[model samples]
Target: MSDQHQASASVSAARALPQLGAWVPGYVLRIAYAVTAAIAALLQFPLGSWLYLALLVALVGALRPRTLAPWFFLAMTGLSMLWAPPNTHSAAFFALLALGHLTHVFAARMLAVPARARLQLRSLARPLLHFAVIQATTQLLAVLVAVLLPGSSGASAVPLIGVIAALALLALAFVLITPLLRHERRDERR
Candidate 1:
């Protein structure tokens, strides 16, 4: 191919791929679902008919494409929270969140890429690491506050306190991630 033809083809190939931030909405929505689930677990909500609703929404989320998937996934996750056991266990809640995080990270590429492309394990690793780090960091902070501030409230305050701390940490993460997101966008434009 001629030089001009080669340059044009390369540009088209680059345009076909999405930037990193393209997956941000899906990732954030999934994290929101996980946080909501944790809050529900801490509250120890009784399992009810909502379990079925969760299943149906999750099915819809899995079947749909692009932005709809995250919304449906969020709905499913929110519904699932209402079905938490009456005595929610921390280990179970964390495990559930871990599973959900992996699901979301894997879905990112599928959601962003319409055309068939080589999906590498390395490409998926970054998002998984980023999400786990965010959740683990907030969880530690929440535990610290929960342990130290016993006088804040009785046992009933666990959910409220943890949610507040986690939300604050999430807000901070968004702020910090902004520059990284912009950098990704700039690279995509080049």
Candidate 2:
């Protein structure tokens, strides 16, 4: 490839970094649910112990819906069987949390599109700014939700660090996976 094209690719990847971090938001929830379920298991709540199983199904669905949607549904149902009606509310929360993160993923792709097509680094710089804006908005919402929900354990320095760690893992996953997914989807459309 020419120097110009190589530079363009670098700019595109750089511009996508913040958008890539969007994937981490939902992972935080998944990891937290796992931690909670571990707590529940230690407490000897059989139903609560299955919450992490539901979360795993949800993660699989998020990662590969075409292959995992049915499996996710089955796992969710099986896990719900152990819990009472009130406990099933956790399932809904997990589903919605997954959906929210998926939406963020789509938003990130949207922000990346123009950058991917444009060969100019300058053109990508602005979209990178928007990516940060989207992340900030969702993070603010995350903090709000944590505060408003009862028994959330509240925000603290530790949770903040958890958020940072989750975001980093999420960003790595997005950077590695999204390009392949996007390329395949585009190829299919064409």
Candidate 3:
């Protein structure tokens, strides 16, 4: 083959590879986010209609993280729990907790960074720590509540517990985000 033709072919191949690679990470993250959201929703609702709704919400949220779609998915998941039968299974509860947390984390990260951007393990350390703290606190609260209200059917307390948990999470988020907001303001002033 002529040298010019060979060089052009090699250049095209190189460009093609990176284009393919760039597409993979974004698609993978989106798919993962959608699946996690769907599972979390189904875990709470577990009905066919709910599954379709969840998937639609998840897809929209995954594709447009900056929109209110993610929040809608979260609200849907939370509301579904209201109608769920009294869940005594600690394992299922914990799984749902983790999955929900994951869904939120993935959505938040996708909002902050482009889907095609590669992430390092170290970048996720802070999120992992936050998850650990929240999970521990929640599990402890669950245990305390279970012990304190052994006679209760547990349905009545679910909303109250959910409210408390949501408040705690919101407080934590505020604490974590304050410094970032300050930094951004400082940058703007400069």
Candidate 4:
């Protein structure tokens, strides 16, 4: 065939292939969640048998972010915290925080939008800002806590403080996100 004819034929063949734009984002997010979960699990229990269970949970959660699987995965990770050895390194802790938050955010996004829907980067600005704010606040609090109580003797209060911090973060999230959600609902009704 002539070059132009061959080029057109190849273009037509490419067009015949299934469009995978939708599948790409969904699967990429799912895989990212699973990988983050696995890493978080490894961070918590480096050499334990529970790693397998965590991996399974992560896979399930990644597959069904709209269901309770994500919650189950979070709960499993939380439980691991109770028995895991103390980690004094702030960097590792921050990494864990980021991983958990990103996993949750990914799951929430999957739940909120259809996999086939196109998302604009501008739509992510607000959420990204919120995430930054949360991370910054948490990191500041962590530094303060570390500075105020610099020994293992004060470690007992760490868990309590963590729970309180989590509750506060949840409240902050609700306050920050509820208005947007309500607006979306109203738009849908309209």
Candidate 5:
């Protein structure tokens, strides 16, 4: 090859190295999820209960996708928090939240592309966007429902708590779903 051609080839090869070096987003996400869960578990505060549960569930879903079905448990937790009345010592609600988190993360991971690839950024963006939208919509809807629906007492607080729950679900879902969706679209384009 001529000198110019050799230099051009070398430049192209150099550009490709970073692409190869890029870490898979899913693996980073998995580590992040675990770290977040561990932090929450150790914190043991008002928010810690919910955060820790979500992280644990996400870890499970990452490890096993088909173990759960339709991610309905996630939806149920979100909807129930929005609509259900409050009671003391509700371990079931927390359990549902955990399950929902697991499925959400698993979905994101499944959709997203492996990290280190040039396209990973684009792939990661969609899931995060979708989750943001879902959480915002759910919170708005919950608030609206709480306001419009008849309540016996302390009506204002119910939807507020629901919105919080919805936010957590949204966060969990985005982390899981974003990765998966990116990969799916990339596959289609291929």
Candidate 6:
């Protein structure tokens, strides 16, 4: 980044939203969701192997969301095996999911956004909240519907519940960050 752009980005970040350590924007959560979807899709038996290979390629090269999405769905067709899946495998599953989500955010910020160097985390607050609410609502409804459906054993449901809980907590923490920073700034003024 040029010195001029760097200067402007800090200014924009300061103006747009509060910083959370490194000025990570709220929309990072959207990237997180996109990544999570890919990972969830990858948790399959045969298809997962391909998605994993694709992820490696994307990491070394550029990632176009369009290119990767179809594979995610294709791999996701294998998810039927999860309906009565075992809980013993959840730890690795959730770990990979989180990693995938973080990787997407990192890729978007570092590679896709040309002006990323000047972008502030604070600028994304409103949109982040808006999308987050939508994601949460739909996710909750899915959970409810899944519960209503037959053949949805507790073992399979538990992992999904855990994934939802983890994501919710992460988003909640990020949501709280903006207000907390604002309050801190106010206190500093006083």
Highest lDDT: give the candidate number.
3
Give one digit per residue, the lDDT tens place, for model 5 in 1-190.
8999999999998877444433354556545544444433332223545645655554664454344522433553455455655431243433333434544654556445343423454555666776567656654544455456555443547667657766998999999999999999999999
Each model's C-alpha lDDT?
A: 0.54, 0.46, 0.76, 0.73, 0.52, 0.51
* lDDT ranking of the models: 3, 4, 1, 5, 6, 2
> What is the per-residue lDDT of model 4 for residues 91-185, given as tens digits with 9 covering 90 to 100?
66667777777777777776765655655445556877888898888777766776687675335566878788779989999999999999999
How does candidate 2 score on lDDT? 0.46
In terms of TM-score, which candidate is strongest?
3
For each of the candidates, give the backbone clash count: 0, 0, 0, 0, 19, 2
> How big is the RMSD of model 2?
15.8
Per-residue lDDT of candidate 1, residues 1-190 (tens digit) = 8999999999999889654442333344434444443443333333555544454445444445455654565545544543332122355445555555555654565566443344444565788689879779755654555466546422355556546756998999999999999999999999
TM-score of 5: 0.42
List the pairs of residues colliding in candidate 6. Answer: 17-122, 25-121
Candidate 2 lDDT for residue 15: 79
lDDT accuracy of residue 119 in candidate 4: 56
**Which regions of candidate 1 fall more than 4 Å away from where they truly are?**
1-48, 75-89, 142-155, 162-190
Candidate 6 or 5, higher TM-score: 5
Name the runs in model 3 displaced over 4 angstroms.
1-27, 165-190
Count backbone overlaps in model 6.
Answer: 2
Q: List the residue pairs that clash in candidate 2.
A: none
